[model samples]
Target: MTAIELRNVSRWYGNVVAVNDVTMTIGPGVTGLLGPNGAGKSTILHMIAGFLQPSRGELVVGSRPSWQNPAIYRRLGLVPERDSVYAFLTGEQFVLATAKLHELADPGAAALRAIAMTDMADAAGRRVATYSKGMRQRIKVAAALVHDPEIILLDEPFNGMDPRQRIHMMELLGKLGAEGRVILFSSHVLEEVERLSGTIQVMVAGRLAASGDFRAIRRLMTSRPHVFLIRSSDDRRLAAALIGRPEVAAVELGPAGLQVRTSDFGAFCAQIAVLARDSGIRLRELLPTDESLESVFGYLIAN
Candidate 1:
């Protein structure tokens, strides 16, 4: 079943169109929103979360209109990009208060379960002002889960988390998805989203750029030249050896190192390791300088 649906939704700000004729459905699974800064992702999230009303068309949650409906919140949970929660309240107090606001029968038990779910029980009594950014995020997550909503929307949720916290959050979200919850998260980082989300929606410059399963979208993305910067002990020799290969289109020795442009990503990478072995040259560093989500968004928008 579709937990959320947007039909021909359009929103504008003083003649600047933020979302243009966008339509989508969020089902019971984890979906990643991929876009650069100012891609209208936040606007879309706000509209779906019932915070912002669409100027045209309909936004629905389970076949019911989501706009200005407090009742829909009973099944919806949102974690905004902004970290402006009740900073003065301790973790436990904040979560308990949120649960109480939902009129939960046992707010204390609900809050305790939320805290435990987020693994913040140890720091539940500590004031949020004294907590780290990662801890604060966990507290916010706990607050969102306090009501046990069926749908969750998170915007840049990996913001302040370290690698460990990021992985932990991913695991938690995966578990949520496995339990058939609607989990939608927004992120500007491609690699993280690629690993975490089953589907991806790409937005570019206030427009929906692309939408599909990540594997299909990744194929679309990798169709372009996989640009690489290679630093090797024998730059001249390696460049000469790789220049005539079918996968290698262009190679140049620049200020940093050797810049390689290849249409075949797998072949290029495999060939690099083989070249190093046969030529007895050690490759110092290999970097994909154009593999960022921002670059991908720019490429898609331009295309």
Candidate 2:
């Protein structure tokens, strides 16, 4: 299986650091790079793809150092977030050009195969400039796969895709991962990452905050209280009932409803409905305030 490794790596431009002493291993399967905007996901991917040089430490793809190694391109395929396709070229021509650049034995056949794989065969004759955002994304994937690289790096691959298009691409990535290819894609959307990848690497302000299965990572943060916003028919009575529960850490009465902090997420969720019913309180709304990735990252950073 192909793998990429980074050891105590750091990258900076002038005085600003983009990646800070990150050491992680990316192996065969789909791994999600999860982080907020400007969180160094792209920077890390660029360095791994040999597009940028690390200021310190080492980065390797298989047995070779990625920096200054043009041969890595033979096994590594990067689909950058930027829109860099040639507007004048048709989708087929674009993939064909990439195949030729990779020195494939038969560029025509490879391009055709890639276009078909990405479900872009129908639009292969259309000029790239005329394609929709999602179509442009598919064409980029077709170009990336033309050479059939073992390691695929995608930076926000679902940026412009609608629900249907996104689901299709997700299935495609899952299939690629199942075929024993190392596929890593960066995304800020938690739902996308949760649905696609089994493992995740989270970056926060250039630092690696968490890594591994998200559920496991969440379990590690047991001390980090889960906050909830709850509105009920009788806010005062519900708040009183919730405060008496052993699972609840604290409860505050608010203008909107009851703001609750729970030490045990699972327990709180499981007992909320029962507690409301027993207290004769009708549930109007219940929202987890700290369920977002940003909130989770903040909790991690604070620790």
Candidate 3:
């Protein structure tokens, strides 16, 4: 299988380290590179694309070192975060130009195929400058796919897309990954990353913080108590009832509702509705305070 491997790789500039000593393997299927801003995701992608060299250790694509290997470009396609399209050219023209640049045998056929794949065939004749942000993104993806590369790297591909456009792009990526291609994309949006990839590589402060299924990672974080914000018809009564439960570590009554800290997340969830029903308190709202991807990432980084 064609895979990218980083073996104890680190990149630095003088006293500042952009990517610390880390190792990971990226193979077939969609993999999400998740991190906050300046967390070395872009730095890592650049190194994989051979645009930048590692300061120390090894970076390999397939069986060869990615650095200084021009041949790797043939098997790799990169959809960069920055806007690099030619605004004056039509979408068709842009993709055709890219196919020509790749020295494909049939640039027109290749360009059309790519344009159709990205759902941009209807707008193929429109100038890129006249296109919307989502249209431009689709065209860039079309150009990236023109050569039929085995490995595709996208950096924040969903950044400016509207909901419908984002959904379409995601579906297209899902198809590509299903075909057994190596699909890797970097994003700071946790929800998007979680929905799009089965495997995730999380980066924090230039270090590999976690890897593997996010759900499994969350289960391993048993040290931190789960917090819930609950609103009921009777806050004080609900708090009184919950405080006695062993699953609930602590409960604080407030104007909004009760702030609950639970030692057993599963048990607390299982009993919350039944308890409320039996107490004759209507449950207005029950929200997990720290279940968002951002909150989960914060916990990982903190510990």
lDDT of 1 by residue, 1-303 (tens): 888898899999989899898888889989998777888999999999998889998989988988978999899889888886788999899999999999999999999998998889999999999998898888888899999999999998888898888888888888998899999999866778877775878877777778867545544666678789999998988899989789999999976889999987779877899888899999999998776654665677777
- List candidate 3 segments past 4 Å from native: 228-248, 251-260, 264-289
What number of backbone clashes does candidate 1 have, counting pairs of residues 3 or more apart or in separate chains? 0
lDDT, residue 171, candidate 3: 94
Error of 2 at 56 (Å): 0.2
lDDT, candidate 2, at 303: 67
Q: Give the whole-model CA lDDT for all candidates, comma-separated.
A: 0.86, 0.90, 0.90
Backbone collision count in every prediction? 0, 0, 0
Worst 10 residues of 2 by lDDT: 292-301
Q: RMSD per prediction, one decimal?
A: 4.4, 3.9, 3.4
lDDT of 3 by residue, 1-303 (tens): 858899999999789898999899988999999887888999999999999999998999999998899898888999999888999999999999999999999999999999999999899999999999888889999999999998999999998899998899999998899999999999877887778875889888889999877766765688888899999999999999999899999999888889999977889999999999999999999999876666767888787
